[model samples]
Target: MKILLRPVGLTFFFLATHLLQSQASAPGGSNLLFYGVAALALIIFFFIVVSVADNFMVIESKQMGIKDSSTMGLFPNIREFFRGKKPGYLDTAHVYTLTKGYDIPMAGAPQDVIREPNVTRFAVTPPDYFGLRPIPKMLVEEGDVVKAGDPLFFDKNMPRIKFVAPVSGEVIGINRGLKRSISEVVILADKEQVSRTYTLPGREASREELVEFLLESGVWPAIRQRPYNRVADPDIEPRDIFVSTFDTAPLAPDLKLALRGRMDVFQAGIDVLRRLTPGLVYLGLDGRGEKDSPYSVTRGVEKRYFRGAHPAGNVGTQIHHIHPCGRGENTVWTLGVEDVLLFGELFQNGRFDTSRLVALSGDSFSEPCYVRTYAGANIGELIAGENVREHSRIISGDVLSGTKKSTDNYLSYFDNQITAIEEGDHAEVFGWLIPNSAKASVSPTVPVLSNDLHLTTRTNGEKRAFVVNNDYEQVLPMDIYMTQLMKSIIVNDLESMEGLGIYELVPEDVALCEFACVSKQPLQQLLRQGHDTMIAQG
Candidate 1:
């Protein structure tokens, strides 16, 4: 099956390319030699394109409630989609809680949880992703006794930021959350006042000093940079830095909530990050309805408003949009809003704090809210109660891009929620052909069904080969040509891939493209291939 399927898939791609070229108008600057080969390539390409287009099954977005004309671009053969009967769910996984964590379809089993040093406690509250202007304040003031993981305060912002206690002890002096009128700080002290303190391995401090300190202290693993999503190397000086104040995915956790009461740690993290990169550290925030931010302290940090979904706030996307990477350029590092404080505290005192805020959502989940969890900790404890409804699918992270990890699986570098939805079992006689009105999203491009605000926990359609040209670009905010880049990488055309800005991409950027692909190509694999290929060449 693998051998037969692989060749067929490749044939489809080659044919698809020819089909696109034929449809597109050629540039006037083209020479005779180029045209000769292009024409010859077209001849052989036509047969393969026609064969694949004829044999393959495609579902039209129009019938599925996709009204946009532009969506046809994602799928090569949009006209044939509405031809026959509609199809049902292609792949389905039950959302369950095992010893590992939440069980998802795509992500498989979760990796073992790794506990870094100096973790203090955990705390959280309602509305993990809230709008700006109303950052939550800590419930406990200076010198107040609190549990290891307790609710610090409710965010004053729209969605509400729930501050969690880092350790069980008396409250310490608030940091910089306080302002002329608004304040948003929560400080926790260790009960013994021992674990609360952080110290570098050596007394002397310089840019290299802190780097060496973090590397030796085991807190170095806490700093994760992008492109490869690995721990930032202390030895290397990063070209750029990125920080996001909020997430724009469907159910992303609000940084304001996660960062509440930890403004000092956040400030400290920023200081450390700046030392590693002489270039600017771009901080992304939501511009829509944003008021004054209480946690922002980095003096020269270039702040930008992310106005779209998913990748809009992705550090990789921000870097690609702002300062694109060129050949031979070093890495660009990024930090999560909450992790910034953790790093700060790690150097300020020697304590390691790994607690984080996790959001629980999905159609099958009875309770959809944010829970406090320790970094790299097992997810089973965070997502509680009867998660599975008869047979449901639980995915860690956003539905479109997240992996279907097991309940026992540990969370990854930049993830916050476990979304559970019912495994769609119902079959339709003409599901694909019919104008689906039962609140199904063919892609973000469809109007009647695309924005159907009534998305439920039920798997409306089966996860077949990703069909439908959803507005993946709307969610994926990047400078690279996602579609073209994927093709170049697949064909191993290094020069074409580089020309299309392959260096500025990461696997997560293609997650939306994968979800919105009509061909259901594994976009993540394609991105991974590009990254691996580029790295290998380097």
Candidate 2:
């Protein structure tokens, strides 16, 4: 199955090079020498011309483009990305600028939730990657009175990176799953719970000192590494850091609107993150909007604009485009803009300030607005008002990559957007035959039913065999052989996975691949399992 179903993208690449080599060595080899040399010469010439053209475009773009607020002199990432001598990685600067993706136009997200709501409860869980679980070390038990900034729990594997209490509250209870792994650390907020203060060092701290400050203050787990999408190791030094300010997912919240008055803390957070990596700190913004996008106004980081459909605002996409994560390149870390402010505010004010603007969106709700609330806050009241439909799926994050939760469930500790989507169960007559113009699908042969077009908690169809269609590649602008990687993962071939560049791939990186897959095989779950298997074998 694996051998038979290679991704077309890789197939064309292999044939293009290997065909020339094999033919050159065939019968009457001496007769074909001139043709082979001419072909090879042309290929080299084409490559040189393209590189020169790209360099010209970069200079022209810089001369005409407006400078960002903080002009950090000489970014090495941009330089290395263009003049890179690495194999298996495309020059992303050109690829990203030319890439295009499908846009799922969702109404009601433009309606920002701007009202400040009261918060009396909060919860923190070892964030689940969909149904995939994590092993957590419990730091506090129920009925224990804890102050804000106090460590609640941390990954037992990476104990130095602690997950802290978002609010000053009493430990009410714990939510667990199979195997008794720690789940949610439910906190009943007193609102006046003791302030676990953070004191900044007087002098500018060294790299180790800054790491200690972030670790001790319980804010270290906020930024996650890309290779495994796991909590970054405290001991390992990062190569580069990525901070994303906008989300390009369907019904994504507007960062410019969300962080309107929070630039001070945002800048402070950027300063702290700059110390984490000796390399560049890249900031990705939504370029589809205005020329002066609010997030583009920020200072003190390497700025890059990505204007495309969904996943354009994804940190993995930005990182891949700006600087592709290569083999053993585990130093890249991505943090949300809101989480950036969380660390900054925690460091500056000496108390945990978990208040952030969460955009509640979807067609289910009556008024989809941005609400000012703290992390782990019981979103029950926030989304309790009259909604358009029932059996709605309330997720703590965006449509893609967000975890599924009930309306009563508290927001995930790491999520900044809560979404409510309608339930999907009913199957239509000839569902795969109806053209779904209302919704966007990568595949053209398969027509998605109109009623099936909307967001739902259900997988519209059943799982089937792997089909190496161009649909997945059309939606994903990243230069990866999706079919080859998926086939390798399905067979649990670690060597093949590594050789195919699975190091740079994450669950979210393949979310679109799953959606576009006619097979309906859960691609995210497979990627997670494959990644974990690699770690377990090691």
Candidate 3:
């Protein structure tokens, strides 16, 4: 079935790609090469053949795995180009078998150096954001004094996974709403910012002891399961664990810059993590470096270097290439680099410090920079005094997958970016209807957008019926049929959803599909709804 659609996906993309590569001032300059009648006939015929073929396709058997190396993987890809390729990385010969996912045109990457800040008051958000509805059980009440590394709350569903306080302070408030579930726990810090240390059983601590300490210190939330993309259940042992060392998202925080001078602690965190799983702890890092970036050099774990675009840095993508998660299988657990640093700090020096550097970016600001702050810090602090144009948006993460927020809101617990972008609310005479060669786009049907462009909330087009054209297959490197999965999702077929490898996806993985959909469907939202339904039932 894929062999039938492969040419449609590859050919259509090549047609638009050449326009980007052309040095002409405009996509066809004055001649309008792509607009010629001959081109129009071919375009219409191409879509007709694909749309007709896709309409009759159906999958009766359930199967999930990486697209055979001879074929495409998640984000069916290209050797597009790597501007930041380091020596010894990205060998042209075997790249086809090695990498997946191509970097698309995007703007607003933070280039600022990381710094530390002293936070007066710190807060911790509930773990429910990941869609893990942990029944909130508060361990402390308002005005109660507590030390750093102390427990603030625990999941009622899984009491062993505790939310730890980051600094010594008084519990200022237990912000709960509706069903009396805890929403936020605010701590008014003591002037000295003290932390209580633990006398460990030593470096030779057993796996069970390590797991217990992580839970006691409130670091258990860092280990998240994949089948559900939620906080891992400490009770169920995982088959393997993954840690992503690079940030390939547009304007992603530089791991090498962020982890500077923290290698010892990072390594210690790796050792600590090793104790929690009897399975291998896979660390994904950037292979584009001539010499191994400090982020990739660690001991006691399997190090896999990824050499491709955006989602390449995503642990989910890496997991697919390494070990595909299938329905009813114990999910592969993934941890972030920051989570490991803190987890190690709890055991290394017994001091808890959540303060770290955050990247501020987007075209709305005059310049992009990094600010030192703690998790859940006030969002206002990061954007103060910036040239925030009228109708500008402040996002808590990257533009592709981040949540928009008012400066008044607190940052999310796992966020490391504060993006300020202009809202694209104003309309154009015939926006996206005519050729605008100056614009950047990956679609052959739309105006050609510059390779580097700023995006907004503009839908650009209206929602329409799901088209069976092979456009989505071009962007996703996964093995499942893009159209079949969409068909299953629209009708809410849980069995088909599972068969389509829904367990191996998150919104970030399909965000490009949302951007490229010709029908302007809220693809990410659909994918989110589809997964949420499955997880709620899983």
Candidate 4:
């Protein structure tokens, strides 16, 4: 229709102009009424032809799976024209500048200096990974000496995915929790550390071979899939893979500091990840950093820049904006920056090197700094002699989403930071009624005098009515309606939950919302429940 209209419209238009010209040139004066009517008809016909052509082009582009960015109708797309543009510092990378989300300012950010902590104990906990069946089958007994990369256990449901030791050591203890479920597989590190090596895959190795290598070597658990936030399935291919190069949670370790002098290894890791997925591997970089950030130069992945407060650095946020995982079979894998480095080290040295930079941070520590330690290093040893307060609460990971740990416990398997904060056991006189300026808050009721506020374990208020307000929306940068979604989860409305975009979320993604919630609702736990319900229903 468009092709047919173009030529016919042009011929009629030219003929009309000629007739008008010929009439005006005749001996009789030009017919003013006829000329006016003819001009109006020509203008209307021209617009109709263009509108029809535009619609046809849009339809054809949709049929061919091409995105049409041009203006539709007779005018421009005002919304796109007024939409926020990418910051000048993003360079050529795709940019997602989020305006929502809050940054919880607190004291005890880790210093840049990296110290060698005398960490002699490390453990691999099975509970860290979601969707794992209770009590994974053990591969080693206590008192067995093993090298790094030696398999310690495997999920009984998926026995191929092995959990390996972080250091060459003696299996000192196989700790158990309630119902005799395996909690921690503790290993006492040796003075002389050794690692087990395996044959590297060939240059032309297939994706299945790479998956098998990762599974067998125990690095596959680092690659987690969305929709359940569990370890990526070995049999299923992800639509895409995502890695956030920076951490934005409160007191989170600076990944740039961790990325220093490891660009080659990181690139190697990217190469390995690329082969596993037929889709592109996406790298999310901090938009506030320099143009020459090592992550920006990384090849074999799609680079995207994110600038915002807390959740912007989250890979879930990046995935939601870039390519969200839909319901059902749609899945996307996500890995932390250190996880990628692990893969790089595996391929580079043909062994699993669990060496990581752990940040010791919080107000309780006398000197908060970065420490070089193995994965699952003892939290007590990591923070030994750093305590300044008489009573402090130790947490493995960032203050927001980290697990509470004690001096006797080891670090969480996936965490790279240990935080120590004051234990808020003492009760305050009318604490809720009295607005303390020293306390940090997202609400306007409390006056926050400074950026850094000393936080504690105390929930300022008890659970109240789940009020429908912008509080959760203020901190959650994603498009999903957090309040309604939580309500859906509470009511167990599976259809409504799915429609509210529950698949795109993980607990950490909503940690900020939980912090900002005026009702003091446990949003992360609720989201986890929603995920479990969806998985069970499927």
Best by TM-score: 4
Worst 10 residues of 1 by lDDT: 93-102
Return the candidate ranking by lDDT, descending. Answer: 4, 2, 3, 1
Query: Number of backbone collisions per candidate, in order?
Result: 41, 5, 15, 0
Better of 1 and 2 by lDDT: 2
Kindly list the per-residue Cα lDDT of model 3 for residues 1-538, writing each as its tens digit: 3444568666766765575346245654546544543465677677667555443332211123222342332222333243444455434322213344545555666665544444566678784357645447778889999987788877667778877886788888777656866667888778777777776757777777767777776677877787767788777777888998887776677877668788888888888877777788988878765766686568999766666666778787788777677554456788888888887677677777776678887767676778876667767655664566678888887777788888656677777888887787897888866766645455666554465577666767788887778667766667767677777888999889888888888777777667668788777788878878886776
C-alpha RMSD for every candidate: 17.8, 9.4, 10.8, 9.1
For model 4, the superposed segments whose C-alpha errors exceed 4 Å read 1-88
Tell me model 2's lDDT, rounded to 2 decimals. Answer: 0.71
User: How well is each residue in 274-354 modelled by candidate 1, as lDDT tens digits?
Assistant: 777878777765543335445445565766553334556666665665566544455777777767877776766557566
Q: Which stretches of model 2 miss by more than 4 angstroms?
A: 1-98, 128-135, 327-330, 386-388, 444-458
lDDT top scorer = 4
Colliding pairs, model 4? none
Please write out the lDDT profile of model 2 over residues 280-378, one tens digit for every residue. Answer: 888886555435456655677887776667778888888876777753545688888777888778665666787777888887777787887787778
Instruction: Please provide, for model 4 over 156-227, each residue's C-alpha lDDT reduced to its tens digit, 9 standing for 90 to 100.
Output: 889888889989999999999999999999999998889897888987998888788888887888988887
Residue 160 error, candidate 3, Å:
1.5
- Score residue 253 of candidate 3 by CA lDDT: 78
Better of 1 and 2 by TM-score: 2
The TM-score values for the models, in the order shown, are 0.60, 0.79, 0.79, 0.84
